[model samples]
Target: MNEEDLSVLDTVDILDSPLDAIELSEPDSATSPPDPEEMLLLLEHPESTQRIVAARAFCELKDERAIPHLINLLQDVCPLTRVSAAYALGRNPSPVALAPLISLLQQDWNGYVRKGVVWALGNSQDTLALKPLIKALKTDISAVRLWSASSIVQIAQLEYESVVSAIPPLIEALRRDAIAPVRSNCAWAVGQLCRELPLNVVYATAIDALIEALAEDQDLGVKEDAKLALLRVGDPRGLKMIEELEQEGWI
Candidate 1:
């Protein structure tokens, strides 16, 4: 056969070859968890995959001793290792991990890494993360902003006070974020905050912003989310607007 024809035949043979059958082993429930020294050694392994596996194992073990090691991995050469470290930190909550996670959220070059940091903050449920998450709304990256908004919502659900400082930025995000989903999520976050805050407390500006979004935002999804937010905040103007939309069949 000519070289080209032989190459094609070789390719077909490789494609048709049977895959290796991998054996799976179940963990022994009776076996003891890995000692701290063993876990630390794994975290320092030359292979990134081994380090990641160790981080996940720490998560499953919920060992607080792994917090510092995981935080160190947040700056690992591999982004995947950093992501895994963030995930492990989130799964295993520690007050000590809070500052490191926040720092990573702000400084991580990778958006996915920042995303993982956001999840870790949300999982921490520490009200201390509230302002940083609010600031995250202004992030140019949509995914980070989206998760930041979600983390805000999660934190607010636990502590109403967490949303108090978040209001102005959230309103701004709803009014002006370039991405429709970020704007939509901001509207949802604002609505959630308003619902928890006292009715007598004046969030007149926020109410007005949502009203404007409902009336004039370019995106239909933002408008709808704004309407829902306003309704959630129990704004009379929002109720009126929804009624009008329903009557006009524009809802």
Candidate 2:
């Protein structure tokens, strides 16, 4: 073939190449974050993966306008979509999302979905979530109980009185929960609940419970957590117990 004909053929061959084999140039400016409206539309897409991506975009945008749409996704048929929506709502930090998240935590059948709701409640730091989270601490699922205890601690850190009612439930979990981590978390939560209160103002019942856990809990981790909780609450008993445990090499 003549040189001109060969050059023309090469160009034609390049044009015929499969699209997937070509590398596209990056845009001059970084691709703009998905528009909130576009993200909302994605949430309604039939594909669960699309909905999850949309939910995650909403989380990153942290736009209050997307809160209502994200809340609706909490009930999406796909568990992953529900989880992402719960997470977006939590990170969005709107009081409007609080009740919906609590509802999901209580009603969602999937442990993964409930786990997301528990985390969302903790991130929200809303006092309104206190009662629901306390109830969650007693749930049959260990993952639920673990997250519930952590959420209670988060609430307690933000506002101790809001979680005061949780103290009894926490004590119950510490003493009676079947899971060792749940008991350990409850101990940590009890310490957090009373961390800011004066020694004399602390709940005697809660303090006594921590002392008992320190002395008698079978899980070494639980005892260690209880010991820290007692010390945080200014209980002398915890110090004495720690010293004794150290002497016995139980610490």
lDDT of each: 0.74, 0.75
Worst 10 residues of 2 by lDDT: 15-24
Could you list the CA RMSD of all candidates, in the order they appear? 10.8, 16.1
Backbone clashes, candidate 1: 0
lDDT comparing candidate 2 with the true structure: 0.75
Cα lDDT of model 1 by residue, 208-227, tens digit: 77888887789999988988
Residue range with the least summed lDDT across 10 consecutive positions in model 1: 15-24
Residue-level lDDT of model 2, residues 94-148, one tens digit each, is: 8888888888887877665676788789888788888888888886367667768
Instruction: Give the CA lDDT, 0 to 100, for residue 61 in model 1.
Output: 61
Error of 1 at 145 (Å): 1.0
For candidate 1, the lDDT comes to 0.74
